[model samples]
Target chain A: MDEMDNQFVTSLKENYQIVFQEIGLLEQAFTHSSYVNEHRNMALSDNERLEFLGDAVLELLVSQYLYRKFPEIPEGKLTKLRASMVREDSLAEFARECGFDQYIRLGKGEENSGGRQRNSLLCDLFESFLGALYLDQELEAVNQFLKKVVFPKVDAGAFSHEMDHKTKLQEVLQRAGDVFIDYRLTNEEGPAHERVFWTEVYCDGQLIGRGQGKSKKAAEQDAAANALRQLNE
Target chain B: MDEMDNQFVTSLKENYQIVFQEIGLLEQAFTHSSYVNEHRNMALSDNERLEFLGDAVLELLVSQYLYRKFPEIPEGKLTKLRASMVREDSLAEFARECGFDQYIRLGKGEENSGGRQRNSLLCDLFESFLGALYLDQELEAVNQFLKKVVFPKVDAGAFSHEMDHKTKLQEVLQRAGDVFIDYRLTNEEGPAHERVFWTEVYCDGQLIGRGQGKSKKAAEQDAAANALRQLNE
Candidate 1:
């Protein structure tokens, strides 16, 4: 390795204590598909494989943590909380805090197009990093690493990040072709200026969630949020 | 604890080495929701919470193992293989092998209705056991336990259990929401007694898979199977 590469490895080790016995694994974690596609002689693979493995590892660790943390919470609630915790945006935040964007190797086009700061890229980069760490350090080490990085955020409630539930719900239901989602205004009451509307969301004629607000749009959003909560997707 | 309960706990400790500091936790692992529902005076919760935790633990451990064992396998193949390994039927088989059916505490109605041997119940039971084990002993011990139970199955090729492609594909896509799956007969040619039929499967108008067989039904099944393999779901 050159002096600059040695410094990069040493810095990561000194800062995050992320030691990779096989340095190639670390390189692979940051290598984007665009980079691999651009370089014919590149000895490294893209981060997708590592991201896949890391995705499972990340999920398992978080789920285990939540299960132990909230002893009384039921499965449905735990699922919802877990979904919120591991969503792409939340993971991208973790990546940004960890400086993963600085390490990503993007092709000229992707770099020019601002791929380094992309949410999906950062999220996948974070997972790939975890995958590399897991291979070199194994589960206990990964657990300890997550305890240091993620657990504090979880404890301080930093990971209770905002989620666009209306869009999220729509995206999920849209992927399944035959299912229909309908938000109906079930009731409207109160004065004109102080009007209240109750909305109920249904999936294939089955009522999934209900919410009330001053406007139909607000009521629909609330209803969509409730549907997401109840469905636990 | 009663005499039967004492014997049960002691036997598990002696045979399986599952020593619980809080015996209530162990008891809670085997407690079914039906049992808690029936016994109003019982001061115990169901296994659902533990199952949820255990499910995460199980996925992480399995993912780590696969990543290490198959260094060259891509993410798509690894995901499909992992899904097969951790599906409900596979977990239920593991539970049966562990003899958890005898220890499950079902309500009189459920017990009489044969809930003890049900695949869903056994799968949840297995996860609950792992959850209780994790809480009592932590990750390393739980890892060792799975290493004994699940790893052997993976090695012996016992875990490549039967999976119906059409059903599994539909279930996954349905969960996603907007994709429609359709099987089309593309070609049929041969003698009357020995004829071959070709089929293609589409997902939302995009051709995803194609296959050939002796009969139309068989060809459609082959097409669906191909779709599952090609889509990696």
Candidate 2:
């Protein structure tokens, strides 16, 4: 590794408080799958697995912090808050703030296509970074990283009761008319263990929107969310 | 108020070590919107707020616990495990086991319709219960409740890598000899803040599924997930 790479590794250890025996894992965490596929001989590992791990750690830490901070919010609202906090856009923004774009390894094609700047990819790298941190330093270190990085970014204003989508949707739709929202099951397929549903939203008689999910209800909610956004816009 | 109620309350405090002051919050946690709407006179306090609080608390505790217990597992696997463990179904099951159903204050209509037995409602109540626990007791108390009621049910065997439909669909389609899954955008309308998109999945020149979401990408993913499920079936 070059001096800059060594310096970067040292800085990460100082920030996350864990020294990695295999800086390879750190490299892997920052490596996009695009990079791995491009260089077949390098035996490069992708960050997808690490990102997945980091996502959980980040969620837990954020969830706990929010719970402690706001004792009055409900589960639905909390879920939304967590969702908002950890969404791809937010995570990507965090990655950018942390200078993740500089460290991530990308294939020439990906680099040409601006893959390093993509929110989805950046978000994945952030998760991978967390995963790498957890792997090297342990959970406590990951927790510390989350506390320092992700928690502060969670908007306090957005999480309050008034800002909740379901609530907002309910209030806005109720004021419009006696319109009842129904989620009709348009289609269903797959095994009994893991079924998926396609649902459409009907507002009065108009077919407003459609959504799909692992279950009928999840699809319906997604449809409702879509409809709500449409109506608001 | 009655003998059964008094005994239940007493047992709750005795067994759980959560004081009655906190139990009051727990009782409130089981109150759903259905119950609140039914009893207009009471202007009832619902479990939504508590559920929100509890959700955050639950995530943190589970994350911390999983982090401590599984050292060898990478972050991605740990995240999936934690998500699987703390999802709605698990929370609802835990609520039922904690005797949360018996304490719920449902409207006569909801009660007659068997609201207490509903898993969805139970999940909310359980979240609210956690919220109340956080407020009435302490973080330690809430952690204790989670350890006793929620942790055991999360068998690692049930945890699947392909839990998310979007990821599953992507993998499935990629393996099915299709490089580009065509998403036909039917419509997109709304403001910058809340935009909705309607899209259809086209594979081999056939529209397989339709979906809608706040963003085009989400809608496309939904369609892809639906298409994947249908293919599997």
Best of the candidates, lDDT: 1
- Against the true structure, candidate 1 reaches a TM-score of 0.65
**Strongest candidate by DockQ:** 1
Candidate 2: list runs displaced more than 4 Å: A10-28, A34-46, A61-82, A107-109, A131-233, B1-21, B34-44, B56-90, B133-151, B154-233
For candidate 2, the TM-score is: 0.53
lDDT of 2 by residue, A145-178 (tens): 7767776555323333434433444445555456
B86-157: candidate 1 lDDT, tens digit per residue: 889989998888778888889999999999989999999998888888888886778888887898776654
| lDDT over C-alpha atoms for residue B182 of model 1 | 88
Indicate the residue-level lDDT of A8 in model 1. Answer: 65
